[model samples]
Target: MSQFPPPLRQPEAERNPLPVPRPMSGRKVLLAVLAGLVLGWMIGMFMESIVANTPNDIDPDELHRLRWLLAAAGALSGLAIESIRQLQAASTDPAYRRRRRFRP
Candidate 1:
C-alpha cells in the first residue's frame, strides 16, 4: 500500500508556460525618459540654490566648475530615476510575477 497520496496533475496548457513578455513600448520608454529628465533638472536646481546661499565667497572659476558638476549630477540622477521607474513597472506586471514564481 502507498503511504503518500498521488501527485495532482495539471492540464497541458498549464504545464507549458507562455513566452516572456515583450519589451516596453516606445511611448512608455519616452515617458520614463521625460519623467527622469524633469526630476533630475529639479534636483539640480535645488543643489544650485544650496550652493548660492553658502556664506563663503565663490570664484568665477569655481562657479563654472560647479555648473559642470551640477550637470553631471543631474544626468546621473535622471538615469537612476529611469531605472527605478522600470523596476516598479516590472514588479507590478502580471507576466513578471508569473516568471518570478518559476525562478529558484
Candidate 2:
C-alpha cells in the first residue's frame, strides 16, 4: 500500500479564490450609515430630554446652544466612523499597490 494516498486536488473553482479588490458592499455600507444615524439621533434626543428636565436654574439660551453643539459633534463622530471604514477597505484592496512610482 502506498504510504500516501493520491493527492486530492481541489476543483479549479476552489483552488483560485474569487475576485480580488472587493469594494465595500452597498448593503454593508448602508447598514453602517443607518446604525450611525440611529445612534447619533438617540444620543441627541437623550441630551435634549435631560436638558429639558433640568432645574429652572439652568439657562434656557445655553440649553439651545448646547443642542447645536451636540448636533455638530454627533455629525463629526459619524463622519469619523465612516472614514475609518473606508480606510480599512482601502488597505485591503488588492489594487492598492504599496510601491509608489516616482515621476520627475
Candidate 3:
C-alpha cells in the first residue's frame, strides 16, 4: 500500500471552470427602485398638468387613464436605464473577461 493518502479535491473554482457572477448589493437594487418610483411620479405629475391645461376638452376618466399610462412608461424607462448602466459597469469591470463582452 502507498504511504501517502489520496489527494484532496480541487477547489470549486478550479473544478467548475465557470465564471461566477458577482453578487449585486441590496443598496444598489433599492436605489434603482427608488429612482424608478421618483421618475414615475414626476412624469405622472407633469403629464397631469399638461392635460389639465389643454384647450381641447377631455373626459375625466380618459385623463386619469392617460396619467397612469405616462407614469408606467416613465417607471419602465427608469428601470431600463438602470439595468443598462449596471450591465455596462459589469462588462467593464476588470475581474472577469468573457468572449461576449459588450462593446460601445
lDDT of all predictions, in order shown? 0.63, 0.66, 0.69
Each candidate's root-mean-square deviation in Å?
9.8, 9.0, 7.1
Model 3 Cα lDDT, one tens digit per residue, 43-104: 77787788789888878788778767766776677667777666655564555454576899
The sequence of per-residue lDDT tens digits that candidate 2 reaches over residues 1-104 is 89988999899978975345456566655566566666666676787788778775677677667666666666666666776676665574545544678999
Indicate the worst ten consecutive residues by lDDT in candidate 2. 17-26
Better of 1 and 3 by TM-score: 3
In terms of TM-score, which candidate is stronger, 2 or 3? 3
Residue 91 error for model 2, in Å? 0.9
Q: How many backbone clashes does candidate 2 have?
A: 0
Query: Lowest-lDDT window of 10 residues in candidate 1?
Result: 92-101
Backbone collisions counted per model: 0, 0, 0
RMSD to native, candidate 3? 7.1
Q: What is the C-alpha lDDT profile of model 1 across 15-102, one tens digit per residue? A: 9655554554556655665665566566656766787799877675776566666666655665666666666565645555554445
- Candidate 2 stretches greater than 4 Å from native: 1-42, 92-104
Error of 1 at 91 (Å): 12
Residue pairs with colliding backbones in model 3 are none
